[model samples]
Target: MTRHPEVLWAQRSHKIYLTIALPDAKDVVIKCDPEGVFSFSATRADGESFKFDLELYGGILLEGSKINTGLRNIICSIKKENKVWWKRLLKSEGKPAPYIKVDWNKWCDESESDTHDSDDDYIRGNSEDNDSSEDDGLLYLPDLEKARRN
Candidate 1:
């Protein structure tokens, strides 16, 4: 399977949802079960290919570990795509699905050629930002036990 142009990206949250147009094949493979270890290929209509296999956490985490690693890899991969397909997807679609929004200024900087290291840096920064926001969210929410008792 080759990565399709349709796949602007994917999010492996409670469930895996892709911001991609449903391929003619109707289903896309996700490496969620084994957690951080996964391999899948997608093909564009023109036969271009994108394949990924991730073994994050040194391949030794439990279910939560898998979920976190999978999510990280997925976002990093999409960010490397330069967000070009995202614009195309928006132009042809019903509504924009949530994708890890890329920082275009940093992403397409003239000093940087597209490369894995740069993308990794971006992912690291993005993850930090996400953590801060999630922390703020927790502060505003009622305690889980109290809510459950209510």
Candidate 2:
């Protein structure tokens, strides 16, 4: 029921970019805590499932963190509220979240609209591929709604 997919993340001067490699995941779900915790889960057609939780390097602008889904991956573009890069990709206390390598083209631009907004404590999205952005072999921004209210 719970598994950790391959995750890749990087930081530019102003943003933290993260991607999870998961093929055949339907009904993908993602969540973020205002304090920088990130989590997600997905199921395959055959019922295989995956989920992972990682503490981001620092706090993020919940209004600016976003999810982009592709045919085989999911990417989150997060903005640092403090506008500074962390010494590492996650919290300073523990072992960092597992990391993977990402291609340079995965870096996105600022002009794209933000698709994530946490009206509550959690948010949700899917891994569908009918989107035009997926057709471009790039990721499609997924609109997210808060998944919880406490």
Candidate 3:
């Protein structure tokens, strides 16, 4: 059975950081549609294979996108086409997806980066700022009736 590699992602002002763990693969195949659809597939030397696809929130500048590898990890930096803020990395029809874990140690806050303001607080420890941000940090909306009963 081919297993998909674990993926971790984060987004900054103008670009998104995606890291995929490709244990034994030295090469990978990636495809991106001009409309912000992205897919990556790779087969490792040991026969492990991975494939993942998703739609991005905003269009990307494919020409400026870069993919690199480090310690069996395939890292991709995708540049946003419009240089605008994406409330969510990918578009969702209903409730937004769970907030992604940002690699803070590896990522620097780009204050000068014009894509967005530093208004999001996905961290669980800080609940005071949750209401102010567009995303509530809850994967799904709370039940209004349940809250009222409580």
Candidate 2 per-residue lDDT over residues 1-150, each given as its tens digit = 566888876565456767788877789999887788888889876888988787777887877566776667776777777865467776767675455454344433333213222211122333355332222122434345543432
Candidate whose lDDT is highest: 2
TM-score of each: 0.25, 0.64, 0.63
Instruction: Give the better candidate number (2 or 3) by lDDT.
Output: 2
Model 2, backbone clash pairs (residues 3+ apart or across chains), number:
1
lDDT of each: 0.31, 0.62, 0.62
> If the candidates were sorted by their lDDT against the true structure, best first, what order would they fall in?
2, 3, 1
> What are the per-residue Cα lDDT tens digits for candidate 1 across 28-119?
35553333353455544445665554332222223322111222122222211122212221222454434323333233323233342323
Clashing pairs in 2: 122-147
Which tens-of-lDDT digit does each residue in 38-67 have in candidate 3? 888888887667677878888888875766
Winning model by TM-score: 2
